[model samples]
Target: MKIRVSDLISRKERSKKIDYKFEIPKFEFEGDVITPVSKCEVSGVITSDKDIVIMKAKVTCTLEMNCSRCLDTFIYPIDIDIEERFANNNSLENEDVIIVLDDILDIAQVVESNIISSLPIQRLCKSDCKGLCQECGANLNKESCSCNNDDVDIRFDVLKGFFDNKEV
Candidate 1:
């Protein structure tokens, strides 16, 4: 969502409080689709300190994601704290600083970035999920596999033959 900072820029007020709620459509990242289950809520206060505008906001949203292990879909809730600074003038050349343009501040990019970074690298359906069995592509969590459990690696066959020929 976009927030107007015209009043603050005009020096009418030293600070302004903002509270916004918006819906985020499903977005794809790295071939994975992330869909939000509900509206995202953001509430914060923006303060103008000299030529800089500082914003601190709390964002909360619930997302639907697939488990990396079992591919099961689940709902994940996220809460993130954001602190950003915008330069009212062009004197600041830091790459990390966001420049305000036309007395408008767009927070959609910031919110999307924070949510993506907050996601876990590996998502599991459960703590001890057995996952899929390599032998017959069976789900180990649901049933036991009848595949041979004592299959030996071919790389160790030479060593096995040498040991078998020697008497203990």
Candidate 2:
């Protein structure tokens, strides 16, 4: 996962080829609202092409999260494809290359960056999901509760009484 900068190739030096592989434990992140399960698998190959290095990575994992609306726990799937390049020697980017590393580049850092960066700003189970009812504390998705629906808003009772008092 770690590479030696001196071992890499540069226009001035002659280290033309490099390859490596390794595995690390799953990562965990804790937030105030939710704690994501750390079950991830990452693998990839690094190929050095002269002054440029090509890194192809595939990550697959699952996270246990609570549904934003109902607060029910559910399994969430994760999959991502990422490609990164490191450049050797400080040269202008006009030469069809990018990201030249100083001496060594950390693959774990790259993978971590991709995972955290790609996450949705706001995680939600669905677009049109109706959350749990504040009154009676019932999940709106499952079944209707016996609790008075009008209890959702007390202000509506004033209107309800006015209409009831009207003689038809």
- The candidate scoring highest on TM-score is 1
TM-score to true structure, per model: 0.80, 0.61
lDDT of each: 0.79, 0.63
- Model 2 C-alpha lDDT per residue in residues 1-168, reported as the tens digit of each score: 577644655345533332333343444444524344654566666666776777777876666656777877666677898787777666735666555456678766777677766766656566666778877778887766776555436766567677668887
Instruction: Put down candidate 1 lDDT per residue, 9-107, tens digits, no spaces.
Output: 568677877688888889976677989999999889888777677889999999998777666777889898999888756776474668876767887
> Among all windows of ten consecutive residues in candidate 1, which has the lowest summed lDDT?
1-10
Worst 10 residues of 2 by lDDT: 15-24
For candidate 2, what is the TM-score?
Answer: 0.61
What does the lDDT read for residue 75 in candidate 1?
89
Q: Where does candidate 1 clash, by residue pair?
A: none
